[model samples]
Target: MQIARLKTVDLHWSEDGDPDGIAVVFANSLGTDLRLWDKVIPLLPQKGLRLIRFDKRGHGLSSCPAPPYTIDALTDDTEQLLDRLRVKTCIFVGLSIGGIIAQLLASRRPELVKGLVLSNTAAKLGTADMWQERIDRIRKDGIEAMADAILERWFGEEFRRSDEAMAWRNMLTRTPVEGYIGCSEAIAANDLTASTSKLKLPVLGIGGEHDLASPPDLVRATTDLIDGSRYVEIGNAGHLPCVEQPDIYAGHLVRFFKEDLNVGAI
Candidate 1:
């Protein structure tokens, strides 16, 4: 739980595995923290992977400013973290808004990113009106007002029946209102279609078969933008596949490192 005190925000982050190992940074989605990747992290082979997971600004233990953060600002926060840690090379694994961040990061700092695993995200998330509606609800009724709907979108009925699902639900509701609201605003404004398509590095797009937020088609469409990129849709898992299907999700990432990037080749 070290803090990277950037100019805009102080990020809470954890760097695990060997320092000399290849850097693999994990970024979380909306309404969740670094802990979102907890299940999937342990499942990853630590032999030659230096895993980095962090709470984005305003999420988890990270410092919060106010409402309405831009995607550029979010990207800046990530860059600062990487620079501060002196991470020379990385394979960024990002989910949802974090996936968007990965796209932006690769475009902005190609030297830093060697490959990517983008899961459960799109070029553009929701329309401005939809984001506005969510913001209105949060401002009026608070985060609890939208917790149930978010859970439904994040996980399926079968997952909802378990204690793990309940735990995530609580995590969603506990997320700072400003954090959720700011990220939502950024999602509404962001469109990484042009930037993502230009990336030539090895990429593996992971989509959840049951995902309602970023459906399989949506994920595939984004992957298609990048020439030579590959796609896989995880079965039975909803939006947060890493939570509901940690083994499968982790397997995909390992395969990406071993096969796609040939991580040991470095």
Candidate 2:
């Protein structure tokens, strides 16, 4: 992994495959590191592609600051990451909070984005007051307080019954409370209905059938707002479909990026 210092944050990233190939950057969800995409990345047909995955500021091994981070600031961090990588334009694959960042990236720096795959996310993440209260609770009592609730929302009941589910729960429990809270606030304040219409690049919106965080309806609504965007929903999965149903998720993503989006492979 290589660490680059951006203006507002330090980026931890890894690049694989042909250096000159079409670039595809994968941005992870909140509270998780780049390892969240472990199952999906290898399944991608990256014979002639450059795959980039990174840990966001305040998550994984990256920098962590105090609260009150804005979505725009997160977007700026992404822009700086791309600039440091020397990528003029690339396809962006983002999940959950990462999807919001992708939208802001396309809107703020259209020249840096060639295509987008937004999975389990929304234009405005419809976080209610209750959700805000929960975030506050995590800030005070720590992330452990929200672990059970997050696990319930992120995985199906059947998954929760399995040993694998317990491991996933452990991962969630290890998330930094400050980073999670900062991202929750960003989600609460996000409203991209107007900005999505301005995007002209190819986009694919995906959601899991059992996703409670960003359901199919929410993803459909987001796609509807964007011109020429496509939508796909995977069954038997929750918020992190790419992890739970990686083969299905990656198939749809690979097809969309390669054939539909016209992103050439090396």
Candidate 3:
């Protein structure tokens, strides 16, 4: 139950493997907590890496401040958390809104991030009007009402039919409405295309074949913004590829660390 108390919020964070090893920090999606990476962590190299993950403000055990959050503020929360952990450099893995945070954080504090793995995300997710409409609907009907439709966007048809999806549904419905809406607002207001285009660090972009939230084309398009970033697509998966296809997702991550970043083996 490690907590990093930032200037404005207390963020719940956890770490595994060697504390002195090179850091690999994971930022999760809008509604999920740090546990989002549970399935993928064990599959990653444990020899020379310290896996770190945190729940953003308003989610998990983290304190909720209020509504109407900005992406920059969310990035600041991440930056502060890392600084508290004394993480001078790291490989950042981000999914969905977490990916947006990665781009902004890398741009603002280039010295802190050594590389990035962007999954099911883009430089700009949706138009303001679209996000506003979604936010309004959630506010009106609550997250539970949208869980079925959201699950469709989040998982492939096969996963949704399985029993495992029930737990995910519970997680989604249990998320604090204020936190979800706040993060939604942050996504609505952010467009990191300009900043992301200027990033020069090693990057790997991943998307799922059945992902409707941020499709493969959009993910690849964001990857192309970086000068030398590589892109891969996972089959039989949707937005949360890490959840549905941990083996393939982890394989790409391991390859990126070894081949692209020249990291040592497990």
Candidate 4:
């Protein structure tokens, strides 16, 4: 693990494989760390690729400042990370809140983004008032109160029945309440439909068929707004499809990165 100071925040990241290969940066979901991509990373064929995974400013091992964080701050942190690492351009793969950051990065710094893979996220992630009420409760009462709720939305019924439920539950429970709430605010306020529509790069939108948080319909709708974007829904998974079905998810990603996006037409 290496730390890079960007905008007074110490960003933590882990780099793997050869530096000469194409850079592929993986961003985690809300309240999660780089560990979220553990299963999916190894399944990827690293023949000509360098993998990079990092913890967001307020999540995982990264520094957590006070609340009221904006997407611009997150995008700036990413830019600094790339600049510090000397990574010229990369294929960005982001999930949930990370997907929102990816959109912002691609829109604001298009020259640094080679391709995009967005999973389980919406262009406008404004949930109903009732959901906001729950978020408020989390802000006041703490993330523990909403742990069960988050688990239900994140994992499928079958996975919840298995021992994997406990593992995932532990992951969610360990997340700091402040970090989660700060990111929740960012997600709540994000709207990138217009920005995404203007992008002319190859994009793959992946979603879990049973994802209630960012449902397949919402994912498809977001991708539809993007010109020439492709969509895929993995079966028997929920919000965190990369964890639930890592092999299948990585297979789809490898195909996109190797065959579709690497055609040299762009």
Candidate 5:
């Protein structure tokens, strides 16, 4: 229940593994709060891995500012929080719109980001018309109107049929109306092709095989933009691999930080 009061917003954040361990910062997807990383955190090799996760503006207990938040503003919120905590550098992991935020943050402030793990995300998602339509729906009908449609896209048929799917659907419906709208607008405007192409930082892009939002080919194309970035896909998952298949999701992270670079380990 740790809350960091940043200048722009009051960000709700949490940590696990170790305070002095190798820092690994996590940013959740558009609809979810920091709790979205719950399953994935425990599966991580916690030897010396310090995990930092936070709820974005308007999500979870964090203060909701308003609608139409820019990606830069979201990144700035995170940067300010990290600065306040005295976390100078760390590997940045993000999902969905969280991934978009990670890319911009790394590009804008390379000194704070040592590496990147982008999961179930893309450089750009949905067309202007699609986002505008969604924006109109939220403004007119509210988030409850599109919760089912969002769930259908977020999960595969198998998970969609299970009771677990309802919980995720609830997560979406529970999201603040203004926060969801703001982040949707952020995603609509984000296209990291140019910034990502120049990133020299080590990157690993993970996609869910069944993800309709950011398919494997699209995520691979994102990896292709980087100099030596790599890509992988997890089965039995949709938009949120970290939620549906946490073990596989966490395994990739363990290998990257431990085997690949040998940074933080027990």
Candidate 6:
């Protein structure tokens, strides 16, 4: 187990593959922990890569501060964690809220991130009213009430019928309420469209064909803001393509890391 004790929070983090190789940091979606990348990590060329994953301030085993967190605060937590870990430069892959963090972090500290993978996310999610409504619903009925609906948005019909779907449901419902709400508030008040449009780094935007949370067209629209960014949509998948179709997800990642960024394996 590893933890980066930052000024505001102690982040739960892990590193895999070669410790001495170039870093490939992963930031998971809301309501998920570092294990979100379990299936995708091994598929990447590990010889010259240091794959890093971590839980943000609220989710996973990390310490949750309180509700009504800001995206700036979330991005700071990630920035502090990376600085504490001495990650000078790396390819950052972020999903959902994690993607917003990536955009904000890269904009704030351009030197820290060389590449980005925005997966199933957009510069701006739903409106504040929508998020507030969801937050209120969760506050009243707990995460379990929204689990079914959220799962529906996260996975396609085929994957939802499988046994693995139950585990994802558990992961969702078991998420700390304060953490979920805190991150929800942070997301509610964020709009990365302006900042993300200014990013000049190499970017790859990935969306799931069946993703109701972040549709392929929405993801493509954000990717189009970048001068030379590329967008790919995974078929028969929803928001969490890494969980439903890791092969396709990792394939795009490996190609971006190798061909686009020229990251070589030993």
Off by over 4 Å in 4: 128-131, 263-266
Pick by TM-score: 3 or 4, better one? 3
Better of 3 and 5 by TM-score: 3
TM-scores, all models, native as reference: 0.98, 0.95, 0.98, 0.95, 0.97, 0.98
Write one digit per residue (lDDT tens) for candidate 4, span 155-231: 89889889878877777778777777777777777789899888888899998988978899988888787788899
Q: What is the C-alpha RMSD of each candidate to the true structure, in Å?
A: 1.2, 1.4, 0.8, 2.1, 1.1, 0.8
The TM-score of candidate 4 is 0.95
lDDT of 2 by residue, 93-208 (tens): 98998999999999888888889988899888865586599787887898888888887778888888988887777777777778788878888888887898778888999988
> Where does candidate 3 stray beyond 4 Å?
none
Choose 1 or 3, whichever is better by lDDT. 3
lDDT of 1 by residue, 1-266 (tens): 59988898999999877778999999999999999888898898777889999999889999988977999999999999999999999999999999999999999999999998889998887788998999999989999999889888899899998887878988888899999999999999999898888999998999998998889899989988998899999999999999999999989988889899987732
Predicted candidate 3 versus true structure: per-residue lDDT over 74-123, tens digit per residue: 99999999999999999999999999999999999899999999999999
RMSD of 4: 2.1
Q: How good is model 5 by TM-score?
A: 0.97
lDDT of each: 0.91, 0.85, 0.93, 0.85, 0.87, 0.91
Model 2, residue 241: C-alpha shift (Å):
0.4
